[model samples]
Target: MRSVEEHQAVVDGLLPAMPAETVPLAEAHGRVLARDVVAQVPLPGFDNSAMDGYAGRWAELAAADGSPVRLPVAEDIPAGRTDVVPLAPGTVHRIMTGAPLPPGADVVVPVELTDAGTEVVEIRARPPIGSHLRAAGEDIAAGTMALSAGAPLAAAQLGLAAAVGVTELSVRSRPRVLILSTGSELVAPGRPLARGQIYESNSVLLAAAVEEAGGIPRRLHFVPDDVDQFLATVRAELAGADLLVTSGGVSAGAYEVVKDAFATLGTVEFGKVAMQPGGPQGAGTVDGVPVVTLPGNPVSAFVSFEVFVRPALRRALGHASPHRLRAPARLTSSLRSPAGRRQFLRGRYDAGEVSQVGGPGSHLVAHLARANCLVVVPEDVTELPAGAAVDVVLIEGALQ
Candidate 1:
């Protein structure tokens, strides 16, 4: 059996780097930037007022000597207004917040400091020069790098891009993944189950996981234990797909449809890894799209995705940190694992303690759903006592 790192290396070697595409800024949120975004225009665009007040020459206002200095308002300026006229030498201009400051104006006095006059304003206090003013390019300069490549466009980043007059962006194209779940005994949800039928869920589970990993997922109907049908289905879905992910039928079972269909294709290699609950794994390509085949069990399929496929998707989409957040926590109970296989047990971590959520069974989907983390046990050690420090991969939000 292969080690986890060896299998991961095989899987990572198969994925091609995603190409960049141009997208409107409205659609760029959550997408990774493909190139450094240079500022098209300086932030604030021009010298503007940071508050609603009077824009005047600071030397004229200071000449009043702590008394109320009345001056005729030269012009009224509101935000987004063009046709701004220069401020008269001795008069003040009524300006609104974000309005462009008139030429020759050296300072702004907030309306609260005066009598809030519109025609003839009373400046009760003398503000410092350049007070309440936003200079051009103060926050960001034109032609300077605003955002770097490989950074995810979050809300603040998007707002900054818009502030710099950016209407579109170059970003990594989201990978399109084709998902298939294969099993003869599998039945779709909301349908009647016969004697030995179980509702197929791995496709939906994996599809959601793909979306969370920043890939677009297209789920195909479940393929039964027939080699011809499986091959036909794969061929049909190969068009326009960047990656292929299949759950089930790769194990050493009598009716392993995926293995029988793809074993002859020189691109795919089927094998086991030194990991519990997700030992059976496969990685290769069909046609030109990369293919990853996970084990049949639900928990095993999900764990395989978290360990291998999710990081590949993130890396292809230009993410820098492409793995789950891992931290160490003290074990709440004793646990045991096989001597040679590394164990990823379903667990719930809180504060500094981690407790096993369910027994080490691959079929326990309920327990897996309740788990927010995977308690990692190394292959070298078989037993862990309570209070032992264990490494855990956090699948949900951070432990509180």
Candidate 2:
């Protein structure tokens, strides 16, 4: 059997970086930057007050004795006021937060330090020169790089771009992924189930996982265990797809539609990896589009995507950190893994302590749903005792 890393390397080799596209600033959040975001204009475009206070020269307020110095408020400046004149030499300006500092003003004394006066303010404290003033380009200078390439655009990043006068951004395009789940005995949810039939859920699970990984998922209807029909369905849906992910029909079963359909293509490789929940794996191309086949069980399929597909999607999307955050946590209970397979058990982690949520079974979807992390055990180690420090991949919550 191939090791987990070996299978991952194969998947990585199949995916190339996606091309970049221009998107409006409103749609750029959660996307990856394709190029460096250089500032066209400096942040704070003009010098502004950082607080609601009085703007004046420092020399007029400085006194050897700690006494109140009252100055006539020469002007009242609120945010968005455009007609700003230079400060009178002996007077101060009552300024609101984010209002432009008039020319010739060197410092601002906060309102709390003086009586709340609109006409004439008494400045009780001596503020240092240039205090409470936000200088132009202090945060970012014009023509300087504001955000580097390969960084994920979050609220703060988008705000920074807007601050630098960027209306649109070039970002890596989200990959279009076609998701297919195959099983003759599987029926869609909300439909009547006959004897020997189960609800089809892999497509829904995989689609959500694809979206979370920054891929646009298109879920095709579940195909039965007929090779001819599966091939027809896949061929019809291959257009415009960057990646194809099929759940089920790759295992060594009597009716393995995916294996039987693609085995003769010579491009796909179907094999097993040394992992407990997601052992059966397949990677290849179908009509020039990359394909990955995962096991049929819901938990197994989810785990496979988490272990392999998510990283490849993130890397193609130009994310700098393509892997899930992993941390070490002490186990609260003992567990034994399979002798030769690495185990990824559903776990509940809190305050640095992690406990297995359920048995190491591939069909425990409910337990998987409640889990916040996956406790990873190496292939070489079969048994672990309580208090053992194990590496865990955070799946949800604040840490993730």
Candidate 3:
């Protein structure tokens, strides 16, 4: 048995970080940027109208009220057209939204205050110093750092790239993951279960975990308890996936296929910690691909995924901070755990205080589902009185 920190240290050194690649900005969503994104071109590119109004010098508008003004709609500047003609002296251009401002124009007046009283078809709103205008380099000047490396691309980022004339960007590539669910009594969902059979939910769950960590799951191979079958399947799958994730078969049971196979190849080391549910753990390289073997219990499997595997996968995909968030909060009730092991207690958080939500047992699956947090109880503390300060990892924070 190893301490939680010990095993975590072991898992940390298992895999190296992955590299980056260039991807289209449209496809950059959900991917981490490898390099800083500098704005090659200014946002809006040039001075343009932010609204449909008239363009004139601000000094000219301040000069007089109802000053007779006549200016041609120079070149009828629409969006995406660069051919801008200068504004004729003492004339206003009938500009539309997003149209480039004509040269020698400093202000825009909306078509509202014409007071011409239907005397003319195009009424000009007068006496506005600065109205309906977007200045050049107002949003972003050229050569500015728009986004930094390691930032995840969002919708706004994509729009920024498009605005800066960047159709594609370089980003970290998604890690390749292979899922292995080992059990003889396991059957995929949508099938009839035999007397001792259970549905194969680990692969699906593990695949989702990998996806959340920015990994591309290559394949999910189901292996039975037999050693020969397990070894064959894992060896075959490892050829493609950069990381191999296996659920179950790592526990200390007489018929544990993962332990049995690892005994011969020495590719995995089975051990336990003081944590609830996710006690049994194993890790090593199988056919040159990093392998993480989790306990069979569903809650244990998921906990192990969050605690160890998710961070590794995230680092492999180039994320800055890959682990779950741990925050300080007062415990609502007392909790107990083993003498020399760190415990992750299933919990719920409300009003900024976290409380243990489930019985202190490892196999309690329903309790985990009802829980939104994992209250961290460190080793060496026997009992925690109600209202004691403890660290908690929120599965979902309260809606702000």
TM-score of each: 0.85, 0.95, 0.81
Q: What is the lDDT of residue 28 in candidate 2?
A: 96
Best candidate, TM-score: 2
What candidate 2 gets wrong by more than 4 Å, as runs, is 397-400
Give the better candidate number (1 or 2) by lDDT: 2
Q: Which candidate, 1 or 3, has the higher lDDT?
A: 1
Per residue, candidate 2 scores C-alpha lDDT tens digits across 126-145 of: 87888999999888889999
> Candidate 3: lDDT over CA atoms?
0.76
lDDT per residue for candidate 3 within 41-80, as digits (tens), equals 9876778887766666766554345554444444455566
Candidate 2 scores a C-alpha RMSD against the true structure in Å of 2.0
Give stretches of model 3 more than 4 Å off: 60-81, 85-92, 103-132, 218-221, 326-339, 348-356, 380-390, 396-400
Q: What is the lDDT of candidate 2?
A: 0.92
Ranking by TM-score: 2, 1, 3
Give the root-mean-square deviation of each candidate in angstroms: 3.4, 2.0, 4.1
Worst 10 residues of 3 by lDDT: 114-123
For model 1, residues 289-332, the per-residue Cα lDDT tens digits are 89999998999999999998988888888887888899899999
What Cα-based lDDT does every candidate model obtain? 0.91, 0.92, 0.76
Could you give me the TM-score of model 2 versus the true structure? 0.95
Model 1, position 345: C-alpha lDDT score:
97
